[model samples]
Target chain A: MAETVSAGASGGVLGGRRSRQEAAWGYLLIAPVMLGFAVFFLIALGASFYLSFNKWDMLTSPVFNGLDNYRDVWRDGEFREALVNTLAITIPHIVLRLICAMGLAMALNSNIRFRSFYRMLFFLPVLTMPVAIGTIWKWLYDPAFGPINSFLRRFGLPEPEWLSNPRTAIAAVVIVLLWSGVGYDMVIYLAGLQTIPREYYEAASLDGAGAWQRFRDVTLPLLTPTIFFLSVIGIIYSLQVFDLVYVMTRIDQTNQLPTVVYYIYEEGFRNFRMGYAISVAWVLLLMILVFTFIQFRLQRRWVNYV
Target chain B: MVPKFSTRVNRRSLLGAAGGASALALTGMLPKIGSAQDASAVEPYNGEEVTITYGFWDMAQEAAITAQLEAFKVHFPAITVEPQIVPWGDYWTKLQTSLSGGESFDVFWINSASLPVYASAGALLPIDAVVGDGGVDLANFAVPLVEMYGWEGVQYGIPRDFDTIALFYNKDIFDAAGVAYPDDTWTWETFRTVSEQLTDADAGIWGAGLQTSWQENYYNFIYQNGGQLLSEDLSTSVVDSPEASEAFVYLTGFFADELTPTIAIQQSNPVADTLFPAGNVAMLPGGSFRAGTYGQADANIDVAPLPQGKERATVTHGLANVIWSGGANPGAALELVKWLAGEEAETILGESGATVPAHAGLQQPWLDANPDMNLQVFIDALEYAHKVPDPVVGFEWQIKIQEVVIEGFAGNIPAEEIGAQAAAAANEVL
Candidate 1:
């Protein structure tokens, strides 16, 4: 018992001293990253929460204005429009991302030619920076001079204003979002597809299941866990879409495809209404938490451990 | 000890006072601050070596700005100056964050639209401490610009350069279309008629390449038509006025008539950087700042005064170099600001043809840099140049106005509705 008690800090017997030194080494090794997290992430998180209830313009010290920022957010026409845009972006992005990722995963799962080449080709967008992707896409979407409109015009097809028109802008943005985001989900789906037992598909086939039936019964249920993961991740990421829209859709200060995160950025940084921006951020956090929570709860119904 | 404590107190309170417009009465309201020569028996600069950062937005002006910084080193060998170049899009946001973080650049270029915001926040140091005998004088610079940088009678900045509106016509585009080159005698009606003549719908060539931009495009027309964006006190917006409406209609008609490149095309091919340089447009109503850019463009272009509306008027805006109050070294920063205001540095700015120097009678180098083009048209317009209203509330309304204007130029908003919607947008902020 005394020896066990010696496991505590400082100036003990040889064994205890060794263990203590090891513990000290352990803490010393982690101290830099831990200190960094505490300073940057945790402190910033706390400060953001604190700033939510204030009227701070960054230039001045914060003035506590209670629930006014939150109250005003409820009626903020811009916020509502942004939230709707977020939903529009998220739903299409999630649905399309999952479908495309699953299709690609299944295609790759088969013994195909140039398998690694195709995989790398598909995964390249995920590796590329969003800003780079946005800039390239912005050029592609340029109305009069872009290759896309030129292609359409060559065929005498009516080319719609891709980034500027309100009617087509969101859809145009979501298409690019899908192109950039689907690759990450596809790689995850491919890993999940490989994890499923080959015997399950064999058993379904032996039980008179066709290719369609085998896929529906064996592959679909097994991939539910992967689907569940991508859904939650897709919802979180798409809900907070910023850089792509910022680079691609903005015309000076006017954001053509305004999303919630972009709105938060504009309010805090551009407008210098940081207190109000933080409140919107907190609302978005709460929304993401609720969505993730609901997804977790719903996953219990359909996600098969088997 | 007492003097040091009082100086610190004055600085702290000055920052607080500068944070609000209500404090902008007179510097006399606050005690004389910063390097008050007589107040300290001790030395302010002990020949200390300090490295200070200078923030500015224009990459086009970087060459000239670097030349100025190189000169600054010669003047004060101990003070190593660094240029912190942020693009115009990100400059304000970064400046605001850097200030609040207490890691701001020592000196930076500030436009008039943003001066009131920064000055009111006390983020700037009054160079008045450096503005006496044997130091810089306020009278040497452009008077309106000197006033533009002043907050409550304490000047926060020294004017670096000013720009006035001019019509830059591509001689190639004009020649191709068999259209007469624009002259000072041209009026708004003539501009419209020339635009009609120059436009070839079957080809991609446009008659004009005007943007819904504030300074370069509409603001000139609005001022020319005798309109004001806001009332004198800035208590309300007067965008609904008939004069403003007329200007909006006249400018939007170019887009409505499909004479200029659509806003959609301009999004990718900005007028200054691409379209005008590419010679897709016959004429461009742009700022004098574009002279450097156009001077280097592959196309042959010459500038004329903006065509007369109700009266021949243009929008004149200037940039001023300011010292950040929150910087690590204020005294060293003050030395740099003093040198920047001197004629030698201003000469480099002019000679580089980056911009027209705000130092009176320094326009010769910029004009000579592009002798073939009518660069003097920019200087002559300064006689009738108008200042854009900087509202006490903020500049967000200008963004709002520009949004409505973009909508108008895109043909999304009807010509008649442009005024009401734009007025409503400004009213929201004002």
Candidate 2:
């Protein structure tokens, strides 16, 4: 009996050692990714945070400047303009995108002919690069020689200057962003629509419900989770809009379409105010964080996880 | 629990191996520092096989610059020069990051607009000692450009090439309108009258493409009208002065009168450059650097002196070759800069007709490269050329001024009001 107890204790020690070895191997397998995250993301993020409180011109060593950069960001007229423009573009973009995407997804999700072909067609814009899309759309909105203007002239209608006019420039940019982004959102919604069991609709029909009534009672609730997901992602993406705005507008016209990220770029790279740009970038981060938090809080009222 | 008799030594060895592997991977990814050679001890052409990198922005000039580099090899056979071409959009950002990171090129191209920023930061090596030791004559370059690259009695750069604006006209449109060809004797009134005659609204052709740009179009007018973009001391903005308002009125009148394409139309369509070559515009004031592209286009084009406003004035800007302060090989870099700014490289650059070399007497070759156009007009305009403003906060002020001026041209506000606003905004930055 004494020999057997000693043997059992040795066995338990061996098992513990084996499990610990497994844990080490698991960590080893993930080491590359962890290292990459530390070096590229974590280190850079920390540096940016540190630099926000200093004065740097990107050519010399940074000098400690306390909250001067933050103060400058608040006082800058261009930064205020950028903030207002960003909100104007992002809010409408999310609402219009959700509506248009849901409509397209509903049509495509129905028992229609050539559904895959239609899906491919609708998803084509998402595959094209943003720069290419922006460039092509810029030409399309050209006031004098664009096809849109030509069509307007054919109809004997006055063609308003779309991009050059400050009053219409932001609207034109929103149109381009919507054109490029709606495809991705529609694909997501279509995926969501397919997950709804056919029995739910059939039962609603058997109960003498009309099409709109069935959609309101069944499809809408089922799609709320997807809508919630997209809204969160869309808000974050739209707030950081840069490449499209940069490609579409010149500095003179940027007031109409300026975004916080683009302003950060102009300050850091063009104006050589690296520290100030980082400070503005931190403000953008805080704004996005607060917005995302509010979204999470609001989702409880409307989002249906089931 | 039943079969826990495995070897404990094996697990210990495996953990050790994993830790070692991670450490190895991380060490590979960390940035290596203090690896550069001690360049101070190395004399010029001491039979050392030193490799130095040269960074420039223009891809179109690569072939000509490559040829120049090959010629440079003949003088310093042991040294190898690697020419890196960063596109214009990303050049400054990359240069800034690399310089701050201590991995910058040995030598790079700098511009008048960027001179003060880099020079003041001590990121550029002052080349006065090198110029003096080599007995390189600064007088060989255009005086304005030499003065442009200088800051606080220290010359930081050697001018590689210069550009001045001139009138580029479509000969076919001129003949069709029956307007006399523009010449040196033409005044502002003559230009206005000819532009009016050349305008054909029914045909959708404009007399000229009047862009809202400050450098290529309006700055010349401002200087000609005795209005300075900034005070002589570079301490204040004087764009609100009456003389500047007159210049603004003259420039914006083209759009207001519909003689040129509306600001909206020009903003959408090809502005002056494409409009002129596409035959949509009869005349355009463009920089000499555009000569190559304009020469290649399928159009009967010619250049003349810019039509005089109150006086004959043009804005001149140029690229300068400077040595990086962080370079590992200052001696070799200085040698390369001197060779590039010398007569041979300038001759090669001029012969290619890529740009007007800043070397004073070598411009004739650039003119001869394109005999079909009056390229000499650009050279002559240099006599009265005003250096584009190069204040410490130049890029910021320039962008602000452009914004207000574009608003004026778009007719959102009156020209005088725009001028005053622009001056106020610029002065705030200054």
Candidate 3:
């Protein structure tokens, strides 16, 4: 009886040892990735934070000036312009993207011929670089020789200066952004639409709900979670706009389309004020965090997780 | 104890040790120790393999530069010269980052706008000692160029080539309009009259494409009108003066009168460079470097000196070759800079017709390269040529001025108001 008890104890001990060895292997597999994140991301993040409190011109050693860069950000008229422009661009861009993406996604989700082909066509712009898109759109917006102006002229309509004029430059940029970005969000919405079980619609129909009623009761509530996710991400992305503005507009045209990230780039690289750029970046980071936190808090009221 | 140590040395520990070792090696944190060389004596080439990189930013002159490099090999057989060509848009950004990283090129191109920034930062090696030791004559180059590259009495760069603005006109448009070709005696008033006569709104052709460029357009007008962009000490802005305002108004009048393409039209199209060559514009005030491009286009074009305002004046700018202070082989790099700036290299550059060599008496070969047009106009303009006004952080201020000038050209604001605003903005930076 004593031998039997000892044998059982040894068996339990051997099983425990095997599981511990497997757990060790798992940790070993992820160690390199963790180390890389530590070195490249976390360390660089800390360095940037440190740089925000100092003044560095890239030519000389950094000098510590507590909160001066941040104070300058508040006083700079250009910084104010950039902040206002960023918000102006972000709100309209998000609203437009949501409406267009949701509407197109619903249309595309139906039974239609060439569905995969349509999907690929819509996703094509996502594959193109922003610089290439900006350049092509710049030519398309040409007032004299572009096809847009030519079309307008054929209709006997006066053509407004599309990109060069301060009044219309931002609107032109918004149009290009919509053309390039709506497809990406549509794909995400389509994925969400597919996840809705058919029974929900059928049940709603049996309850004497019309098409719009069924959509409002069945589709929207279920898609709220996806919508919530997209808005959070979309707002963050919109606030950080730079590449399109940089490529589409000249230095003289910046007043119409400058965003926060573009301002950061101009200060850091063009003006060689690295410290001030970092301060601007930190402000951008804080703004995004607050926006995302509010969205997360608001999600509880609208998002249905069933 | 030995048996226990052997048991602890497992495969995972061994692999981790190796990975850490390689990471340290790859990061270049390990110290390097080498024997010191004597500082007093200059070392001659002793058949050692030395490779040096030369950075420049002109894709159009690649072939000419390659030929020049080939010629350089004849003088120094042991040293290998590698040419690195970056596009103009990305060149300065890459150069600055490389400089900060302590991995910059042995030598690179410098310009008046960027010379002060780099020289003041101690990123350039003063070449006065090298010039004195080699007995090179700095007097052979244009005085403006020499003075432009020198900061605080320290000559940091040797002039490689120079450029001046000239009036480029399409002969087809001039003939079609029944107008005579522009000459040296042409004044601003004559230019305005001829441009007005040549303009045809229905045909979609303009008399000129007066781009909102400071160096090629407004600066010439400002200087000709006897107005200064900056005060004598270069610490204050003088662009708000009445004379400067008059120049601004004169330049923007072309846009207001529809004699030149409006700011909106030029913004969408290729500006003057394409407009003149495509026959959309009858006249274009452009840099001499554009002669090669215009010559290649399918248009009959000719060059003349810029029309006079108060006096005959033009803006001249040039590129200089400067040695990097962080270069690995300073001696060899200085040698390369000297050779590239000397008469032989200048002669080769001149013969190629790529640019006007800064070396005196080399203009003949460049002029002879294309005999169809009046290339001598550029050489003549050099007599009253002024260096582009470049203060510390001049690039930023130049953009500011362009912004204000563009607004004036758009007719959104008056010239005087814009000029005052621009001057105030520039002074804040200065």
Candidate 4:
């Protein structure tokens, strides 16, 4: 009986040693990945935080100047204009994208012929580079030679300036943004549509519902979760829209399309006020946080999941 | 007995080693040792390979500039010139970052718009000592162009090329309208009349294309109207003066009168040069540096001096070859800069038929290179030309003007208000 107990204790010790060896192997495999993130990304975040507090003009040594940068930003009239412009653009852009993307996704989900071709056509804008898209669309919206004006002229219509006119410039940019962005949301919604059981639609139809009624009762409710997900992502992206606006608008104009991020660029690079630019960046971060939080709170009521 | 023997062995080995080392050190100190043998093993390099890179934003004339660089290499076989060519729109942003980072190129082109800001920041290496030591005289280049490179009586760079605007008219349009060709003596009234006659609505062509472009359009007219962007002290707005307002009102009147295309039309087909070439515009106010481009165009083009107003003035600007600070081998970089700015480099650029070299001696060759058209208008405009004003930060004024003018041309506000708007914005920037 004593010999048996000794054998069992030795076997337990051996098993414990094997488990410890396996745990060591797991940690060794993941060590490189963990080290890479700590070294590159986390280090960058720490450096960015420090840089945001100091003033550095590339060639000279950086100077620490407390929150003077924040004060200067608060006083800048252009910064105020940029903030308003950015909100004006982002709010409308998010609304339009959500409506159009959901509408197109629902329509395309129906038993439609040449469905994939239609999807590919809408997705083409997403694939094209922003610069190339801006160039091509700039020509199309040209008040003189563009087809848009030509079509207007044929109908005895007065051609409004699409671009180059300050009043209409922001609207034109929004149109381009929606045209380029809606397809991405549509693809996401399409994936969400596939997950909804077909029997839900059949049951609604059996209740003698029309198309719009069916959609109002079934499609939109089920698509709310996707709608919520896309809204969060879209709002975040539109708040930081730089390339499209930068490429579409002429560089010399100030009020035309001065998105908040572009304002930061103009101050930091063109004016060489790095400290002030960082202050503006931090303000934008706060604005984004507030906006994201609001969307999250709103999502609880409407974004339903099975 | 064995353990005691092992311990004894260890003690003997340690003491024996220490005593041998001490004896060798004492012996080495007693006699002369040849350190020369060690020094020969690690010799400093006498002939080292060095590379100097340059960044520029003249993509439009890159081919000709490349040819000029190749000729520069013939004189100095030791240095290789590497060029980083970026587009003009993106150039200043990258240049500002590179300069501030102290990782800038050895040589690059500097513009008046951003030069003072860089100078104040000490991003440029003062080339005075290098220019004097290298014995490259500046008198051979155009005096005004050379002066653009200096600030506070210190030379910072060598002017590479100079440009001024001249009237580029489509000969076909003049012939079709039965109007006489514009000459040096032409006034603004005469220019307006010719433009009015040349415009044919049925044919989808305008008489003249007046760019809403700040410098190319209103600024040129402002100088002609006896107005300046700023006072001599660079502290206040001269833009809101009666003369500057009159200049802007006069130019935009063409749009109001339908003599020139609307801002919408011009923006749709943005390139002013393309419009004149394609017969959509009868005449264009374009820079003389575009002589090669006009010469190569399919249409027959003629060049004339800019029309006069209260004063005869055309915008003249010079591109300078500047050496950046904080280079590892500044000595070698200075040699390359001096050579490139010399007569040989200028001659090569002139002979390539690309640009009018900054050197005064190379002017005739540059004119002769283009045999088809009379290229002498550029030289003639030099008499009436004034350099574009140099501000502390150049792009600030440009951005302000563009913003103000867009509202003016859009008819949102009176063109008369443009001066006041521009003045207020520019003063803020200043």
Candidate 5:
């Protein structure tokens, strides 16, 4: 009887040792990643945060300036203009992108001929490089020789100076912004649409609902999670628009459409005010954070999940 | 149960400690963290083989430059040359970032507008020592071109080429209009009348480009009309003067009368060369560098002295070769910069038919090479040439002034308002 008790105890000990080994393996697997984050990302964040407080021109030794950069950034009119431009361009861009992406995704979700080929065509813009697209679109936005104006002229429409005119410059940039982003968003929405059960649509149809009615009741509610996801992501991304403005507009063409990132670049790189640029970067971070918070707060009201 | 929990914790802690150790080592190894001091050290040139990277952007002149570099290698048999080309629009941004990050090339080209900003930041090595230490003979270069490379008596670069804007006219258009070819005696009024006589709006051809470019247009007019951009002390704006306004009006008057294309038209079709080459424009104020560019084009063009305004002045902009402060080889880099700015490189550049050298002794060779063209207009304009005034202590004020000029050309506001706007912007920087 004592031997039997001893055997049972040993068996228990062996099982415990095996479970402990498995747990240790799991922790070991994740340890490298955690360490990587600590070493690279955490340290970089701390360094930038410290630099944001101090005045450094990258060549001279850093001096502790104690929020002077922030003070100057607050008083800067160019920063304010950039902030306004960022919001002006981003809001319409996000709205149009969401609508266009959802509309295309819905259309693509249906049984259509050459669906794969259509997907490839739609995905072409996503695959194309941003710099190349920016250059090509810059030419297309040319008021005289561009196809945009030529197309408008065919319909007897007055061609507004697309890039050169301050009034229409932001709008023209938005067109390219939407054109570039909608493809990626549509592909994401298409993937989300595929996961949704077809039974929900059938059930809605059995209840005497029309296609639009079904979409409003079933498709939209199910797609809410994806739309919410894209909304938050698109807002975050559009707020940091540097390449679009840099390529579309000349650097010397000031006062019309300087995006927040471009403004930071001009301040930091061109103007050699690194401390001020860091402060501006911090402000951008705060703005993005607030926007992200608002999205998260609003998501509870609309976002649905199975 | 206690033994099991203790074993799991022990294993977790062990794994974590190992990761923590490795992580510390890895972070210590990142380029920015480890390479700052290493960047300052010059690598010894191995006798086996060596390569120096030369960064440039003008793809249009790549063939000529390649030939020049090939010739340079023949002189320095120990070194191999590699050319790195970035497009113009992205060149400054890329070069600036790389230099700041200590990833710069051994040698690259620099421009006057951006030199001060880089020099002030210590991003560039001051060349005064190198030039003073018998590495280069500064006396061979034009004094004005050499002065442009220095800030407050500290030299940072050597002149690569000096260019002054001159009037380039379509010979065909001049013949058709029955107008006398532009000569040294030509005045602003003569330029205006010839433009009006040559203009045919119905044919979609303008007599003059009247380009919105600040370098070619208003800045030249401002100086030639006896107005200055700043006070003699460089402390205040004089652009709001009556003389300045008169100059602005005279330039924009052609646009107002539809004799020259509006800023809107030029902005949309930025083919200053294309229009002139296609015989759509009778005259354009372009530089000697562009003379070579148009020579290769379909245009049967001839050069003439710029139309004399009140003062016979023209804007002179030049290119330079600046060595970065922390390049892998300051010695070799300095030698390369000096050679490129010296008679050797200038003669090769002239023979290659690229641009006129800023080296005084090298001018005749370039003029002789382009004997078919009126190359003397460039050399004569150098007498009236002026560099864009240096900016305020930290910022590049030229960019700000150009911004205002572009605003005027875009017709964002009235032409008269542009001067005041420009003055305010300049004061903001000052």
Candidate 6:
């Protein structure tokens, strides 16, 4: 018995030979994916990193021009404008998305009629193609012919040109971003909500807590981890917005509806400044890293794994 | 996706066209074909069974292009040709990535705007073989069009077709408004006054839909106003002149007075295939290529001379077939390029009514394709049409000009400040 106990402890849960053979097969099965990752991701990452230092138009051979591309990015007024626009989008999107998702998750988590249908309805946009989304919304916001403007006109309200006006374009984009993005956050929040024990709510109720009080004391504290995860990911992804902007409102990269990725695209492909675009991409990566680091540092104060 | 109206590329000006003196001088310097026995033959097809890819935009022209290729098959049966048609918006993006990755079509359509940039970058294969004995004659095509494809005396492309800008007006609207059709008699004041007379805002109709394109609208006006976009040397922007400022202010009055659709409405609804055909606008200053689509629309449309400012001027641009330097079958590609530019293929292209063939004397068929419309106005305008002035760097500066021009059209920039701002913006990019 003592020998068997020692062998079990030494071999983990499986027999030694069986485990070794399984491990070997597991590695063999995963080798192709690993090779793909190394070739496509790792190698490309290194090449792009090296390219960030060189002056290349992708038509001719790269010439090593250290720090010049980076210096150009630092002074790029378009990039600064793109950053401001991205933040303008990211902050409001994150806040509104969290609130809307939490509200949806809570409503769906209760004994609501047709709960599954409502949940699926909200999540459908998440599954739809961004290009399709942009195309539909472009028509929807069409000032002359769109249903939205028609509805506003019928109500005798002012109808601002949604995608064309610089001031209102970002607001329209955020509404879309929230509509397409909130469902994903809601799904995550639903998982978080379920994890919070009913015992907490019951205990709160016994302590003479009202619905709002119970939600404040019990539901809010427990959902911090989910909120933190969503925010960090949301900022990183939203900062790189290109598809919706490119499809819906990409009028002129220098003036109207310029975003960071769009700026990179204009600089690299359109402007034929591949090296400078790579430098911009690296700056974006560093920004994401700093943002994530700050979020992680700030997480300790609010996030509760318990 | 909103279909782009300016498919007729801004052949923005071609090289060797600064003046008549340079043109004559270049005529002498053009590489001689038959004089040298050492000159290579263009037909380099071996008995090898191989395939070559030909990429282009404009699916509307596929049938004609295909018919030409089928004719190419009668000569070289061993060569299998594949046609890749990417949309205009994605064509350049795909071209860049594919060329960089060493996987691109053997031959593709190129324009003056991109030809210089690609040639300078060494991305284009020099078609010297096709410029020599037993090949097409350089003198057979228009001098400016031919010069548009040559870089440092090495030819890189063959002119496929040409387009000139003109006024496409709804005859029904003109008749309804009891206004005369746009003709050579009209000037800037006439255009504006007629626009004001034609506009019926209560019916949600604007007089015109000025496309927010530098080539289609502003370039014509700027040039017609005797305003040069660039100096004679093509080194600096000259749009800040009083003539250009006046023209800029004149064009904006149409927009400000609601004679034309606002930039916002045009963004979602283009003037060419959408609003103009739907009878929401009275007139459109568009490229001649728009006739193919407009002819199919249920409207009485006709073309007339673009009302001149100081001179009867319009911007003419052309597309050329060029071989990619990285193509696997250069011999096959060259053979296709030479054959495509030949009279036989041009006849087929013109007969199909896809566009006006660049070959001399083959434009009659395209003209007859739309007999109702005065398509002759396009060929006639060629006399006064200026090539899009392409700098050695590229036409990317045009984008900068457009960014400022769009705001100017939106009535955001003050009239006097708009021209100077556009000049400064273009100079910054240049």
- State how far residue A249 of model 5 sits from its true place (Å): 2.5
Between prediction 1 and prediction 2, the one with superior TM-score is 2
What is the docking quality class of candidate 6? acceptable
Q: What's the TM-score of chain A alone for every prediction?
A: 0.91, 0.92, 0.90, 0.88, 0.88, 0.91
Candidate closer to the true structure by TM-score (higher is better), 3 or 4: 3
- Candidate 2 Cα misplacement greater than 4 A, ranges: A1-15, A251-256, B1-45, B268-272
Candidate 3 C-alpha lDDT tens digits along A1-306: 233333443668775566446545645776798568656665556567767988876655567899999999989899998898888778888899888889989988999999889888888887899999998988898887889999999999989887777658778878877888888998999999999999998899899999999889899999998889889988998899888878776633334467899889888877879899999999999999999999999898889999
Tens digit per residue, CA lDDT, model 2, B1-430: 5323234336566455445554454344322222323323445545688999999998868988999999999999978999999998789999888876778888999999889988887777777865755656997887889998998888989999999999999999988877789998988888888889998988988887776567787898889888899888888888999999888888888878888877776665646556778888888888998887788878789999999878889999999998887677788888888889889999999988889999888988888788889898888888899997788765788877888888788788887687799899888888
lDDT of 4 at A150: 92
In candidate 3 chain A, what residue range of length 10 has the lowest lDDT sum? Answer: A1-10
A75-188 in candidate 1: lDDT tens per residue? 999999999988988898899989998999899879999998998898899989999999998899898889999999999999998888866788888889889888899899
Give lDDT: candidate 2, residue B264: 70
What is the overall TM-score of model 5 with all chains considered together?
0.86
Which predicted model would earn the best DockQ?
A: 2
User: Candidate 2 docking category?
Assistant: acceptable
Q: Which lDDT tens digits does candidate 6 get at residues B1-430?
A: 4212112122232111223333343243222211212114333667689899999999889999899989999988989899999988899999988877668888999989998888887778888777758488877788788888888788888899999999899999889878888888989888888888999988877887788877788889999999888998888888889988888898888878889988777777877768899998998999887888788888889989898898889998899999887666778888889999899999999888879899999999898887888999898988998887889878777888788888887766776678899888889878
Q: How much does each candidate deviate at the interface, measured as C-alpha RMSD after superposition? A: 13.9, 10.5, 11.7, 21.4, 10.2, 20.4
Candidate 3's chain A scores what TM-score? 0.90
Give the better candidate number (1 or 4) by lDDT.
1
Clashing pairs in 1: B18-B120, B18-B121, B18-B122, B19-B120, B19-B121
List model 3's recovered fraction of native interface contacts, to 2 decimals.
0.23
Error of 5 at B204 (Å): 3.2
Chain B alone, model 5: TM-score? 0.87
Q: Identify the superior model by lDDT, candidate 4 or candidate 6.
A: 6
Please state the error at residue B90 of candidate 4 in Å.
1.9
* RMSD per model, one decimal: 8.3, 5.7, 6.0, 11.8, 5.8, 10.9
